[model samples]
Each structure stands twice: as structure tokens, then as C-alpha cells.
Target: MSSGSFIMSILDEAPTLAQPRSTPKHEFKGHKSNIWSFVFLHDNVHIVSGSEDGMMCKWDCDTGLLVGEPWESEGGSINALALSPDGKTISCGRYNGSVEMWNTDGEMSEDILTGHTTWVSALSWSPSGAHIASGSNDGIILIQKAGNGEVEPEVGLMKMRQLEGRVMCLAYSHLGDRIASGAYNKTICILDNNTGKLLVGPIEDLGGLMKSVVWSLDDSKLYSASDKFARVFDSTEGTELYRFEHESFIYSVALSPKHNVLACVGEDGVAQLWDTESHEPLGQLFHQEDRKLLRCMSFSRDGQYLAYGGDHENITLWVLRVIAPELLVRAFMIILQVEKPYSRTLHPCLHHSPASRQVLSP
Candidate 1:
């Protein structure tokens, strides 16, 4: 099937449900400074986070506990973190303008990719696990070969592209052939991964600094989050598709790999979920006070949960639940104390049914 046709089919199957609410399940806290970036490990049972405290640490998802000794970044604070597609290594971008990789198994140094002249703000691993892409405040994007600790800075890193503003975020397309990067200049650039050539943009003039960018699972659309908006654009043509407005500056956006939901968090401290196909708001999960800005968000590979961290030191985990219409109505009724038998029988299908009786039971 053609790529466009395949993407359409995927979008048609994307789930559509009423706005759902999320409940926080776990809170992992330990970082001494703001947690800037994080990514889920391949197993979904662990997560690694980078912090302004100049440390990167792993945590157990199930227990909400630290997994190993924190890796110290002696040069400066860590600004970005990404896991290799094979799940074998973790890469971190530091304020000192260096990218460091560590083996997940032994937590030992794997490689250090250095070339950026300013803080490395973004990092993405190609879906094939063969390359690591990084962006820096120096306004350059670098693609480096993923390897053991043998790569020398002089020969290992290749300059991919240079932009007019700081590269704030980077994401590899699902096909592993293209990359989408957001920059402080309020634009998005699409590049060919293999040849490091521009394919679509400097898609110009977004209203604010582009904080995050993500590609759809089918690689048909690119989504970006910036000040007060999350937008979808045609991945191939670079045409604007939809714009989702927010109450405040948006800090991060994530697309679920297992579901059709797109999640975003912002300065409002509310994590909003939207339907990918319709571009409609789904539901919202509130984090700290509205004054606190949420900086990062990530979805699990299975799409079962979402994790976000921000101005606060603790990381919050939320479970995603898809509720049936009947159950949803019943839950609303119970919460409202609508206990009368007549009220319970309002739905003709539920009249005198065992489910109705169960719902009405004290």
C-alpha cells in the first residue's frame, strides 16, 4: 500500500472516546533541581530522567523507587535524555554542550559525542538504533553513529543541519528515514536522515518558540507544541492541518505509540489529551498548581500510562483508562448520589437489568 493510504487507514482506526480524566498513580522524587527531560525505557517498567542538578537517574516504574546510582554530569546540568531504540543505551545532552551515552545494563560509559558549541537541548535516537541525533543552542543538529566508547569527536559526529535559532527538540520519523526538529526561532525543520539534507522546512513563523515536536506513528503528520498552541502539519507537504489552542505556553507534547491519542502539557499544569484524527480535545489531567509549568511528558510504548515532570521535583505517572459508555454513566451517577431506582431506570436498556441492580446497590 502507498504510504499516504496506509497513514489514512491508521488514522481511521484511531480510537475516539469521550473526554477522559487521569488519576496520578505514582510520584518519583529525588532530583535536587528541575527535571528537564526523560524517556521510558524499552521495557516500560523503568524510566530515566535528566535534571538541572547535573544528574541522570533511573527509576523503577512499578515501585516508584530509584533503580541505580545517579550518573553525575560533572560538566553541567543535563538538558535532554533519550533511550536507544534497542533499549541498550541512554543518551543525555548536557549544559556543557556534550552528549553522553551510557550502557543500560551496567550503567557504564558507552560513548561521548561532542561537537555542539552550546548547550545540547535535544536528542533523539533513530528508530533503527543506528544513529543518535542531537540539537543544541548553537543552532546546529548533529547525527552521530551509535557505537561503543570508541567514537572520537573529530571523526564520529557529522553536522546534519544548521538553523537560525537554537534547536529545542528533535524527533525521528517512524520510518527512520526522516527527522523533525523544532527550534527557538519558532519554526520546524524536516530533514532526510541518511543524507542530512533538508526535505521540507524551516516551516516558518510559528507564534512562539517550538518546545516539542513529534511524528505520527504512520509518519503522515508532524505535531509541534509552542506558546499557547499545539499544531499538526502535513508531514510531506508541510501544510498546516490543525491548531490546538492552550490556556498557556505549551512545554511538551507526546503521541501515544499504541493508541491514537496525543498528550500535551504546558504552563497551565494541565496535561491534555486529544484525538489524533478529529483534532478534538479528549480529557485533561491536572498536575500541580496552575502556576507551575510542566516541562516534559512521555507515553509508554504500550500506551497504558503517561509520565510527566516539570517545575516540581517529583515525576507523576498517570494510568490511561478507556471506559465503556455504560460504565461512564454509572460512575457519574454514583458520584452524584443519584440513588433512586427511577433514576437508575432512566435508560430503557438498563431497566430491571442485573447491571442496573448492581450499580444501584449500597
Candidate 2:
């Protein structure tokens, strides 16, 4: 094996510390207004955020430094942001009822898309990076192609749907075959992306206004955030599976892709982590103050890092330690399995050999 691989193997066999507690790793500041949405890029090393100040900023996760000058949006206060699957571009939703796309690798240009009649509140990119979905207060959802350049405002476009109430959040399934949207009317809708048919919901009156919606890694379950709780639902049956209680209204929920960790942040000023299968609280990460609501949270694709924004104008990054303890135990077991037979052959106590029996007969 290569020297690097050998070193890594040695490190893996070493006794690891207890689940490493999360600490405030880095803080990205300078949003003049509240940051409404942020997402980690696919590379997991960069984060892009949008704010009510009409600014979109990118940051390097390792250094907590701004990547470039903040990009200004002409659509007024930016409300939501989503990164393309390849991480080369980002889409921003604004209060002016427009969705804009910018190439993150090049100069930031206003590739404005005008479609929504009211403020655009939610934006999500399809898994395949082919389409971008935007939701607005006008009760409309628009799915536009990724490289469409610029678009003009139209009431009923080719890929548009008018739901019951103002759409507040949107998420695309992992397969890119369906879209789930949560609205101001306390309803969650799952629509077939190909046929534009309502597939699952109008999951109405979910205890409070639906603030956010996310899909499980396998796309078999849906998790929604709302007043005082985050609820999980079976994707196929549309039945409630579990309801996670929160101290205050939940603003966002994120599921780890590589582990069964579920994280939620909200009005309580605490980011809580949970075991998705056991329904047990794993840990709580508190903000600087106790009353400021956390507005948005996201998990990196690898599930090793988490990023959240709040009313405090700063975005906080955390290193999630959910899998460390388990890994440590597994490493110990592997060593034990390999050494057990050799130990039994050398140690008489492990086998009832005649000499061992005679010695023990005393």
C-alpha cells in the first residue's frame, strides 16, 4: 500500500475520541440584511448565500473568507438561492417576483428570469441540473431549463403550475422525477415533474404554515418544517411517520446524505440534531443569542459539514460528528476479529487442551 494509505489505515485503527462535539468553526459575515437562504456547493468547500439586502455572497468554507465582491441583484431583496448540481452556477429568487441565474465560475451577470407575479420565495435545482424550480407568493411554480439565458414574464408558461396558496418552499426529489412544494396555506404538494400532475399532496393543515420541505436520500420519505415541529411523511403512502418536537417554529430541516442525522434550526436559536431512525436527539448547537431565529440551514453533500444562517447577519459553519463514534467501534471490532484466532492458538485458556485442563484441575 502507498505510504499515505498505510498512514490512513493506522489512523483508522487508533482509538478515536468520543463523538466530537460541534463548535463554531467559522463565521461568514457582512450581509447588510437578514440572510434568507444559503447552500453548500457540491464540492462542499464553498457556500453561497442570499440576503434581503439584495446581495449574494460566496465564501470559502476553509478560510471563512469571501470569494469575491458580493454580487448585487436587480430584482430587489434576494429571498432564496439554489446551486446547480455541478456547482458551477446558482439561481436566486428575489422580492421583485423574478428568478436570476449567475455563473459562479465566471463574472456574475444578471441572467434575469421574469415569470412569477409576486415575490419569489423559494428556489430549487433539479438533481440532473437540467431545470430550476421557483415558487412565488402569487401561488405559482415555474420550472425553467438551466441554460435558458433570460426569460420574459408570462402568466401561464409551458412548465408552470398554479397551486392553492403562496408557495413558500420547494424541493426536488433525488431522481428528478418529482417536485415537492410547501405553501403558506399549510399544505404540501408533490407534483410529477414530467406530467405536471399532482401526485401525492394537498397535505393540508400540517399544524402550521409549511416553512420548508426536504426529501430523504432515497426519496422514499419527505420531511417538512413548520410551527413547533418537523414532521416526516412516507413518500408513497403520504402517511405521517414521525413528528419531531421543537421549542419554537422550525424554519428549516436538513437530512444528512451519508448518515442518518437530521438537523433542524428555527426560532429557538438552537440547531438540533437527531437520529433519523431512533428518533432521538443527538445534540444541540446554540447560537450566540437565545431568541434570534435561524432562518436557513443546509448539510453538505457528504454530510460532514453543516451551514446555517440566522437573523444575526452571519452564517455559521459546523463540523458534524455523527458517524465518528460508530466508526471507532467498528475499527476496534475489525482488529479483534483478526487477532482472535491467533490469540486462541497461543493462549491455552481459549481451548480445552489436555495440558491446560490438567493445569486448571488444581
Candidate 3:
């Protein structure tokens, strides 16, 4: 259709695209066991993942090549992973109740941070890259200074909080003022980042066991994933703002840094999207034929790519280009460009082939 015709149709109502099956642009495949957690490097050039195989691998995002040899975790299977805001440091929480640090250049540090009595389950880096907040199966949370390649017996330790159940997930607000944590007790807590003082809850009655939590770009709201729902709450009041229901147990939740879109993945083997402002489900659902239960999810800094893995040995990466009313302002239609196996001419229409989910064979 002509550009003039495209503009008019979009002004009325955007065309709907068919659900997309799992077609990853790249699948990094070095891990020998289930992938547990991963993080995008601050520069958005590389991705680092830790798995049940007790190994951490870094892959170049552009080329999909392993940057170097995988780094073996000293403690045990890694349960959580976090990268410093500056991308200079990597922190991994292990099953052995310990947290270790490594520079992005593949250099492991000498000092190990330890205090939790059981498995270390979650971790988040302070916005300034100076501190780290960690959660463990032992129901303890610690806010400590990040390692600088030296050990001094909790030298930079800041504060600690003991909860009633395993701490499952944590996120530092973009404003750097507070931290949010979700636990097995079905509660979400907000604490002052500096003093580690409880600012909010133990906010109870979330639909189910808390799995993941993240802060809005401005830090005014918090998004969390639980049993079968992805919830949004007011950061200061800890009040429920909205909840998006899922078809299966939701294991992970991620927010686009540059857009108002939230992505979620779970047991159904589908990745779903929701508009943060409208809280309405998007038209596309990313799925795979194997139906692996996805336990981890993350969006790149620019909101142009998404990565997820779990119950599988490889991490899948997708290129996402979203065209929507909120983003374009003048455009009424929502168009999504997900890298596919076959190339097609760029069209302005809203409908696309339903068979766009074929991944390129490795």
C-alpha cells in the first residue's frame, strides 16, 4: 500500500499480527545444565549467563560468539547474577550461600562475601556500583560495599535484614534511593538503600509466591511476577496499581528501559508483553515448539532486544522493534519487528504471516 494509505489505516485502528513462535536471532549454547540467571552488560554489547552447571559464560551480543572460556563458579551452582551499573564487575550468588565477584575481563576476585547460612538466591547492584544487596534462602538480606579486589572482613559492609522466609528476588530503584525485595513468604518489601531501613512492607497477599521484582525507569512504580500474574505497585505506598494475568506460572518479569512495555515469561513456554500505561496485553506471544519452562528473562538497555532461558541449556535472544501509539505519539498502529528466519519486504500493513516463529537452524 502507499504511504498515504498506510497512514490513514493506522489512524483508525492498527492491524493485529499473529502470535510469533520461538524464533531466536541467536542462541548461545555453552551451558551444560539448566540456565538459571543472566544479565546484560551495561554497555549492551555482551550478555553474561550463569547456570546450574556451575559455569558462567559471556557472549558477544552482536556476533553470538563466546568471548572467552567460561568461568567456573567457586561456590557451586549459581542461583543469581547481577552486573554493576558501570559494567566493570559481575556478581554471582551461589548455592553455597556465598557471593563472589569477577571483573568483566574474566578476572575473579580474591575476596568472597559470606554471611548467609544457606543458598544465596538473589542479588542486585546499587545504581552507583558501590554497593550490592543480596538475598538468600536463609531469609537474610545484606547490603555491603562491593569488592575492590581486597578482603577486610566485612570492611565495607553496610546493613543487613533478616526476614521470615527465603528471599527470592531483589531490584534497586533507578533513583538509587530504595530497594525492593520479594520473598517466598509472598511479601514485597521496600527499604531505604543507604540506611537499609524498612520503608514499606512485608506487603502481603500477592496472588502467589513471589518470583521476581523490578522498578520502573523513574522508580515511581514496581513490577513483580508471581504464581500466574505480573503485578505493578506504587513504590512509596506499596499499593497495588495493576496486575496482568498469565496462562501459566509466571517466573520472570522485565521492563523495557526505553519504553513502557513489560515482558514476562514462564511455564507456558511463551513470552508475553503488556503496555505499562494501558496494562493491556499486546497482540504477540513468543513461543517455542519444545515448550520449555522459561525461568529467566531480561531486556537490553535500549529496549531493542530480549533474552531468556531456563529448563534448557541455551539462552535465546530476540530482536524487538516496537512501533506503537505511545512511542510514536502520532502513529495509531502498533507494529512489531521480531527478527525471523526468512526475510520479507517491509510493509506498513498490520497483518503478518502466522508462521514467523521458525528459528534459524544452528
**What's the best-to-worst order under TM-score?**
2, 3, 1
- Model 2: per-residue Cα lDDT over 1-362, one tens digit each: 75334434544543233324435778898898888998888888988888989988889989989997898846799889988888888888889897787777535554577778878999888889877888888887887777763332441242334356678899999998888989887888888878677789778778788899999989999999978889999987788999998888999999888878788889877888777887876544456454577989988887778889978888998766432333323333455566554333332221334533432243
Across 1-362, the per-residue lDDT of candidate 1 in tens digits comes to: 75334433433332223234434778888999888898888888888888999887788889989987887757698899898888888888989888887777536474678878989999998888877888888887777777743332542343534467688899999889898988877888898877666788888888889899999878999999987889899999999989888778899999888667788898878777777766656544456753477899998887777889988877888766432223333443554464443343344333445644544465
Q: CA lDDT of 80 in candidate 2?
A: 91
- The reply for model 3, stretches above 4 Å from the true place, is 1-22, 148-162, 322-362
lDDT of 3 at 103: 87
Report clashes for each candidate as comma-separated counts.
Answer: 1, 0, 1
What is the per-residue lDDT of model 3 for residues 70-118, given as tens digits with 9 covering 90 to 100?
9985688989999888878889899998889988877888868887788
| Candidate 1 residue spans exceeding 4 A from truth | 1-22, 148-162, 322-362
Instruction: Go through the candidates in order and give each one's C-alpha lDDT.
Output: 0.76, 0.76, 0.77
Best-to-worst order by lDDT is: 3, 2, 1
Model 1's number of clashes is 1
| Each prediction's TM-score versus the true structure | 0.80, 0.82, 0.82
For candidate 3, what's the RMSD? 7.5
